[model samples]
Target: MEQKVFAFLMFSGQADEAMKLYVSAFEDAGIVSAKYYPQSEPGAKPKVLHAIFSIKGQQVMCIDNQLSDSHPHAFTPALSLFVNCDSEAEINEVFAKLAEDGKVLMPLSPSPVSTLFGWLEDKYGVSWQLNLPAR
Candidate 1:
């Protein structure tokens, strides 16, 4: 089946940093495309305007808040990105990288429903769930 929906992430001004961290944490991830604001642009910070990144081939869209943006909305733990890891080593590696300067809601350890599971909110305020499916 073809993918029709994609996860979209919004950051106040950390879109680029978050994208970099995510891409670096996952082995099969990379920034597909990114548009950034020029310093000359009025009232616009020199930051990511829009970006499309892929994690394990799943396309995710993200953007930094615009100049006219007024909402004080910030990323909440209510929503999180769930990653299914291929192995124990993969989960540990990915989790360790993501956990840097981040909050760990759930320690990486054996869980009731999975062999290994962890939940965290990254330094940029994005939440993520890393899991190794039961074998």
Candidate 2:
């Protein structure tokens, strides 16, 4: 059976911001659905409990983990979102938007396998690899 696999991003109270940034940065992207946590206490800030968003037709699930600080849920570069960009300009644009306020592991450069490739960790700690595939 063919299965639809979705990348799930677990954020430490940055799910909403990340979702907004992703939806705005990528073409043909938008939030599919989201559920928020109600303000349980006085002056408590509301947060995204769960959400689903698509970036360039790829569906991603995410949530804000309240117990993230104590849990070993830090995002690592081992499992990054590998983006196969359609063009050099597209890869550059996407990299620029996602790399803002983030750390660049590998700057955009041509490789033997790709004309342009780069890896970065976004502000919310999610890792991404942008690549321009051969036509």
Candidate 3:
């Protein structure tokens, strides 16, 4: 079986805001193809139900809190996006931008596999791991 990796982000009732922030981040980073959820039906709760955005050439799936059954822990840092970058410069740029107004779990620096690496939770509280492969 050929499996693919998709990052499904969970937000605490801020999916739309997070999606907007992410789209801005990716666009500022020069990435393309950012999309968001459709408008809800009448009396329906609006949500970022599904989206496909690229981050440094990687496809990522994003969504808002629409389902009632999603557990709180299911949206924790353990399930953050792992961004693989091409250069330290790119890594630093992306990480610093995403870290604004958010918490930094690990500062950008050399890791065993990447020249620059960091872990950050975006302003929306969705965690992400930015890494630049050593070249």
Candidate 3 lDDT, 62-133, residue by residue in tens: 666555455553457877888787666667777888899999999988878877789998887778998777
lDDT per residue for candidate 2 within 1-135, as digits (tens), equals 432898988888779889999998888799999999987888765578999998777789999897877885889999999989888878899999999999999999988898899999998888999999755
Q: Each candidate: what lDDT?
A: 0.89, 0.88, 0.68
Which candidate wins on lDDT? Answer: 1
Over all chains combined, what TM-score does candidate 2 have? 0.90
RMSD of 2: 2.0
Error of 2 at 45 (Å): 4.8
Clashing pairs in 1: none
lDDT of 2 at 30: 100
17, model 1: CA deviation in Å? Answer: 1.1
Instruction: Report the poorest 10 consecutive residues by lDDT, candidate 2.
Output: 1-10
TM-score to true structure, per model: 0.90, 0.90, 0.69
Ranking by lDDT: 1, 2, 3
Error of 1 at 31 (Å): 0.8
Task: Give the lowest summed-lDDT range of ten residues in model 1.
Answer: 64-73
Model 2 residue 13 lDDT score: 79
Superposed Cα deviation of residue 133, candidate 1 (Å): 0.6
